[model samples]
Target: MMGNVDIFEMMANRYDTPERIQISKATADAIRKYLVDTHDKNAIDFGCGTGLVGMNLLNDFNSMLFLDPSQKMIEQIKQKIDDFNIRNADTLCFDFEKESRTNLQADYIFMAQVLLHINDVELVLSRLYDILNVGGHLLIVDFNKNDEIVSDKVHNGFDQNNLTELMTKIGYREIQSKTFYFGSKLFMNHDASLFILDSRR
Candidate 1:
């Protein structure tokens, strides 16, 4: 995971390129579809990189917590918060793999393009489950199953049904997932599609 952390840290300053920002906006827009009745809840953008996706959703939640393992990414988010004069947004540089589940409680937690970087998907998902309040929701936007991309450090993608089943075993309910977008060179520089999974705690 050091490689993943180092990669993100090095890319923090230049993470918001035009293409990346466009993709982030599209992902954020897709995520917003399932956010009904969430305006009054607190949110955590787990594995948030530079707050690009979460920042697009600040007004949708009462408070936004940008949680990531990369300190440099958190610093970029800090700078964004300061520049925008955002009062309800905060940042935390926390790694779920290295650290136990944190006391951080949120009514909603969303991870965009983040699961692939995780070494242990089940452990991290279960830990995030523990961090959520009852009746809260977890939203994940990740690439759909892809066979072309292969890597030792990251997952190629995920199968929605299998992911839903995994979440069910972890005690999540009302699980629903669907592919929402397709893009060129999206996953590991291979053309890929993205899916959004909504699960309740």
Candidate 2:
């Protein structure tokens, strides 16, 4: 079976299609609603492939880190950052689930359309919780459960209630979750909706 990193590396060059940009825009907009004027804050975009979502939100933070498992994806994001003359952002290629590459800390950690790709969701969430500074926020954007979507590698989707319970178990507080966007044929050609869940560590 092809690992997630290899799969993403192969798709890196062609990953930023029009459809994807649209989806990212929607996700970013939803995230923006919950954001405050934190010009001095730092953020990390975990599983930040090509930085479509993270790049759009760079102005919201003082500095941003784009972290992905695929080297090619990180390369693409670096190119985008340079091409746009975005000085506040940097890119790193690391598989957070398997190893720790940097001892960086952040006030905010954003994950958009990333949870569905993770197999051990609880473990990943726990790791994220540990890296977040006290009172830091973890913002997650992922699809709501859809029975119509089936896959061997990706999760079918997520149940917000179950996910909230897991987040609580991981020591998060002030958890707030809501469905933010809906699209037709969004997930594996099945009609699906996306949700944004924000929690403080």
Candidate 3:
């Protein structure tokens, strides 16, 4: 496992930040719309941070498994869910690098801002493909590194061209992307994007 201790610590500290709060709602809404339109009920929030995505999902989804490598983050999420009185929720502290060790399968998976922290993006994508049911959708939201405003070195951003190529190479089809502002600017000066990828047989 790639020592995600710092990542979890970061979440524990900044789980209530304004930027995180704002981005979570927009990202969750976009993801929720895609999942609902496809009639997907069973879902998982991969890299779920302090359950921000889970918080947005509570009203629309009845059951969801929240998975993260950070125990501290999961604890924070548990607190949030408890405060909201949300039920039928579960949390797992495991690494995508070790996903083969777990049995995680769902109709839809929401992963926000987690891709940038991962070094083996392609490998994780394959793992996600393996775990999702047929006709499943994977929603990814991250800052595109190519965007001029993104100043974080840890962020591994992807432009539309590279993202499409990666998804296609992984045997994913029906890939679509949309750009949105997720940070300091209201007009999307930050190069963030939301991707919807459909699993293929």
Candidate 4:
């Protein structure tokens, strides 16, 4: 829908503020609980910005892929990887919505605060569903829909029940979701709540 590459590219350098790090830490903690054992599993943090969530959860997987359309954002993740001496992570600058990208299969796929930015939600969800290995899991963390937050480019947020129904339509099974965190000014400077949805392929 909206081209977020330019906006994210400009924010790449200063993206990791204390507030963001705290939020990522909370997200990582929630995800960690669902990971039974990830020593041999491969994970992808789709739309990962600066490796905040993926980096924090790196130890749970054998390999982690950071994908985003903004080169500057990828650059920031690379820098963090280097600074932290992280060896199990890789970066790819690809936009699944606009580009024909391939050869990416993961045991786990994590998306945090990303679904709202896309123009076509179902198409992107279908693409992501196709990229997972059989029996793999998809974890989506995003805001619950808010009528107060309005934007022409973004979807305000999503309703958990509606999102679950969409995932079901896309062929996901054993889907489970819950709201795990709440924050003030979390979305467009308005108070919003965050939820995590887990679905099996």
lDDT of each: 0.91, 0.88, 0.71, 0.91
Q: Candidate 3: list runs displaced more than 4 Å.
A: 1-4, 10-13, 37-40, 99-102, 147-153, 185-201
- Candidate 3 displacement at residue 43 in angstroms: 1.0
The TM-score that candidate 2 achieves is 0.96
TM-score for all predictions? 0.97, 0.96, 0.82, 0.97
After superposition, candidate 1 runs with Cα above 4 Å error? 1-3
lDDT of 3: 0.71
Q: Write down the worst ten-residue block by lDDT for model 2.
A: 95-104
Better of 1 and 3 by TM-score: 1
Q: Taking the tens digit of each residue's C-alpha lDDT, what string does model 2 give over 51-150?
A: 9999888999999999998999999998898888989998887877785544778999999989888877887888888888999999999999988776
Q: Taking the tens digit of each residue's C-alpha lDDT, what string does model 3 give over 1-201? A: 334557577658566787678778887877766654543367788888787877678556657888888888888878877886777788888888765643777777778877766777889888888888888778887765554554333444667668778878987888877765544443235434444333442
lDDT of 4 by residue, 92-167 (tens): 9999888655578999999999898888888888899889999999999999999998788789989999999999
Give the TM-score (vs. native) of candidate 4. 0.97
